[model samples]
Structures are given as C-alpha cells and as structure tokens.
Target: MGAVLGLLVVAAGCARQVPPDLVAGAPATTQAGTPAGDIAVQVLRRYLGTPSENSFPERAFPTVYVMDHTFGDAADPSGKQAGGAPIPAATQQRIAEALAPATKVVFVADRETVLEHKESCARVKDDAILITLGPPVGDARRVTVGVNGFVACLGATWLTYVVQYQSGDGWQVTGTTGSMSIA
Candidate 1:
C-alpha cells in the first residue's frame, strides 16, 4: 500500500498543470512555422543586389521596396522603415517568378481598396498600398505586403509587410511587419 501511494503521488506530480488563465476546453497554444519576414528579406536580396551596391537606380519610378516588417511601427514609415532601394525591372520580374510558386499575389490599385481590405480582413493593417498574398489551401498562412508612396519624405515611400498564420482559435501575426523605404 505504501508503494502504491508513492506511485500515485509521483504520477500526480508528473501530471501537466494548466495555467489559471487557460480554460479547460481551450485549445493548446501552438508556435508559428518558419518566419515569413526572414523569408521575404532573403527573397528580396536574392533578386536585388547587396546593400553595398548602388541597388536603387536614379530614374526608376515607383521604386521597389523591401523591409523586415518585424521591427518598426507600421503607422509611421519613417520610424520603422529600414532598407529602401529600387528594384530594377529585370529583378522585379525575377522576384515575381520566384515568389510565384508559393504565394498568390493580389495588387491593389488605389489606397481606398487597400484600406477597405485591410479593415475588412481579419488581420492587422498599416498605412500603405496593400498587396495581399494568399497561400494555397491547407497552408493556413497569409502574407500582406504594402507600399506607401511619399510616406516619409518627398519622393520617398515605404514597404510594410506582414506574415500571419492560424493559431489555436484564430489567426495571429507570426512576427511584426518588415518595411523598407525608397526616395
């Protein structure tokens, strides 16, 4: 009987304890998959040249921007916008082709549509032209890429992008949005 009691005590101690805030039927918390910010930066770098190079061309209009989206404030482009550079036409094409395999890109022409979608969609929003990327079915992840023209200073714009995946009950931002600025 002593041995049985000892075993029972050990088993009881080993049992998992739920935190006070967690309800009995609550779904188990899950960590996100691979970070989307790192992937986005890597992809951009693969297409565009390194920082040392004169990546932003002087005459490129509506320049291309890529940011980490995990650091700075999405509202103020100047605050969090980190790397701003222009992407050459060829490089832009390459980026599209490369990202085509995993992401479905949607381009929003005007600011109103972008704002509308950002407001309506069950996701966070920033002040930028929205580019929504839908993952293939069963992926359970979505990426929103945005570019705000003339955000920080004259002739400057910023890119704010976010990666989110479904959590236990709802979707959550995996990491903060990454941003880039170009002038």
Candidate 2:
C-alpha cells in the first residue's frame, strides 16, 4: 500500500509539469516594458472579428488583413505622402486622449493591405487601428486596449494607433469604429 501511494504522488508531480504544446501555443502576455509593436499586435488580435448580426447587419468584415508594409515603415515612412483621405482631426484627437498618461509613444501606418483574405475587401483599402497601454510605475498587471477601424466597400479606409505605458489598471476599450459594405 505504501508503495502504491508513493507511485501516485510521483505521477501527480509529473502531471503538474506544463505540456510542451501548451507552452508553445500560449499567447504572449503584456509586461511592464513590453515593446510598442508587441502590445499593438496583441490588442489587435484580441478584437479582430465580425460584429454580431444584431449589432450591424449591413456590414460584416473579416478578422485578419494582409500585412504588406515594410519593417519600421508602418506610419508613412516614405515621406512622399500616399493618396488617401487622412484620419479626421477630431478622430485623431480622441485617439490621443485615449492613450493619455504615458511615458513613450509609437506610431504605425500602412496602405493597400487586404482584409479578411478577401480579394474584393483588399480593393477597398481598409484601415485598422490598435492601441496598447501599460501600467504607470511597476510591471503592468494588465493591458488597456482601444481599437478602431473603417472598412469602405467603395472607398478607402485609414488606420492608425498609439501605444503607451505608465502604470494603472486592467485592460479596457476606450473607443472603436468599424464598417464594411456588403453590396
């Protein structure tokens, strides 16, 4: 009987070990000093999806988009200026306010990326936004999130986002806007 009890204890200890698959598949968590891009991508993935029928029956879009921008040039790095309507000043101001009380800020922008792997959606020039926030002082216990996007079936969409970390509370969405045309 004692031998059997010892064996059971050993088996339980082994079972407590984390599985290799779970460790590999686990999503990265936000830390106090996580990079801006990492935080942005994490936030974006969390909210990427079509809205429910009751929310917006006329417009439903995909969750992921084709990322074609070069590294480090996410926010109009060319300096020549691309052809598309810029994000409105009022909207931009709101985004800025959402990311208040931060030590640093990063900006990213891209154009001509396809949305939801759909060829027709690609032509629409959909713009997506993602924001990530960190704690005020010590390591962040959680992340604050704010995302917005506009998908125009007939026209172009503009995307922009900001990341900030200072020290505060759990993650929350401050603002968001999205639309897509079916016809």
Q: What are the RMSD figures for all models against the true structure?
A: 20.0, 19.8
Worst 10 residues of 1 by lDDT: 1-10
Q: Each candidate's lDDT (Cα)?
A: 0.29, 0.27
Stretches of candidate 2 exceeding 4 Å from the true structure? 1-32, 42-60, 68-155, 166-183
Backbone clash tally (model 1): 8
RMSD of 1: 20.0
TM-score of 1: 0.23
Evaluated against the true structure, the overall lDDT of model 2 is: 0.27
Residue-level lDDT of model 1, residues 22-141, one tens digit each, is: 112222222333322233334233323322111233322222322211212222444433322222233334434545544322222232433323333422133222321111111224
Best-performing candidate as measured by TM-score: 2
Q: Give the TM-score of candidate 2.
A: 0.28
Lowest lDDT block of 10, candidate 2: 1-10
